[model samples]
Target: MEKKAVYPGSFDPFTNGHMDIVRKASAIFDRVYIVMAVNSEKRRAFDCRRMQEAMERALADSGIRNCEVSIYDGLIAEYTKHHGIGYMVRGLRNNMDYNYEENIAEVNKLIDPSLEYVYFRADNVAVSSSMVKELRHYGQDVSSYVPPAIAALLADGNTER
Candidate 1:
């Protein structure tokens, strides 16, 4: 079976930390789907289209051709089963995230036994989507945290790519 994984997140702004996970996952999986999950419980600063566009541009610029961006609604396990993907990639910024992801992983495992979660810890947890968003909100340049293409978008005072 082809080794494919789903990296699901809101991705309000695709950060370099996200790129790092994609780059790493590319080495192992034949394909990585950067899934933009629209969970009603979480709030987002940017819409899915803008996030998808930024991701597409970043992927092209970063030369990560093994991955593709797609939007999905409902449980990720269901999405994975529907798409025939067996692995899910998740990024953890800290122990707090791990605590949360661990429970989610258990739930997902129960939902689909074939589905597995691959967790990658960010090397620079200080530079996360929340941090970038907070910095940008204060009119600060977040070019170092996210991809250059995305940083340009934030620098432009909007999420246009």
Candidate 2:
């Protein structure tokens, strides 16, 4: 059986940390689906399509061939179960992230008992979507934190690329 894993997240702007996880996960899983979760309750900084395009470009540039990027609007647990994907991947930077992710994992398990969670520690603990946004807001270069495509999007300042 082919090993498939789902890495679901908001990915407001795909950061280098996210790229790191994708690079590593693609190595082990036969297929790694980078699912972008769309939550109505949360406000996002960038358009979903634009973010997805940027991510796709970055992933392509990195030569990660075993991954696909898609947008889904619902609970990831339900998405995984409905798609028959058993494993889900997450990235953790610190204790706070672990605690929060663990809580989500528990809830996901309740929703789909067959679902399993895999966690990867981020290469740079300081990289986060919020930090990227803040730095960009201050007119600081965030190229080091986010992927090149994402950095271009951020530097463009809401203009379509």
Candidate 3:
């Protein structure tokens, strides 16, 4: 019985903040699945394939072998159960993030009560997918927030100096 945990999100750009949470989780769980959640309900900036690639590149570049990236479309609890993972990792950046995650946790508990949720605060400055998207929209460099591979993609699109 291996200990596996999931870290699911859109990960529009795999930011360093996101990597920090994965790093913390990997220490605890034998395997950390960085699921790039593909929720059809939400109209996000990037697609699942791109997000998955960014996460993979980021993880490989960081030399993180205990973690892997996957794509999920349905409910997250279902995904966790299907993969036999009992833990889920989330980065609580602020009070709002806590509240939102708490609410989601309650719902997920109803679906799979055996599942556990692990929370970690941002190791560095707080970074969110939405903030990264906003920064890129303004053609700003997001090297500090996102990984090198993602930074290259963002830089290619940015027109502002």
Clashes found in each candidate (C-alpha, N, C closer than 3 A): 0, 0, 0
Q: Summarize candidate 1's per-residue lDDT along 1-161 as a digit string, tens digits.
A: 78999999878788988888888898899999989998888877876787788789999998889998999889999989889999999888888999999999899988889998889878778878888888977888788899987876666545533
Model 3 TM-score, all chains together: 0.91
Q: Which consecutive 10 residues in model 3 have the weakest lDDT in total?
A: 152-161
Model 2 TM-score, all chains together: 0.95
Q: Higher lDDT: candidate 2 or 3? A: 2
Give residue 19's error in model 2 in angstroms: 0.6
**Candidate number achieving the greatest TM-score relative to the actual structure:** 2
Candidate 2 per-residue lDDT, tens place, 1-161, comes to: 98889999899888999999998899989999999999889888888898998999999988899999999998998888888888999999999989999999999999999998899989988998889888877888889898888888777766332
Pick the winner on lDDT between candidates 1 and 2: 2
For model 1, the stretches where C-alpha displacement exceeds 4 angstroms are 158-161
lDDT of 3 by residue, 1-161 (tens): 78999999877767888989988998888999988887778776665676677678878888889998988788999998888889989998788989999999999988888999999998765577778888867887778888887776666544222
The TM-scores, one per candidate, come to 0.93, 0.95, 0.91
Show the lowest summed lDDT stretch of 10 residues, model 2: 152-161
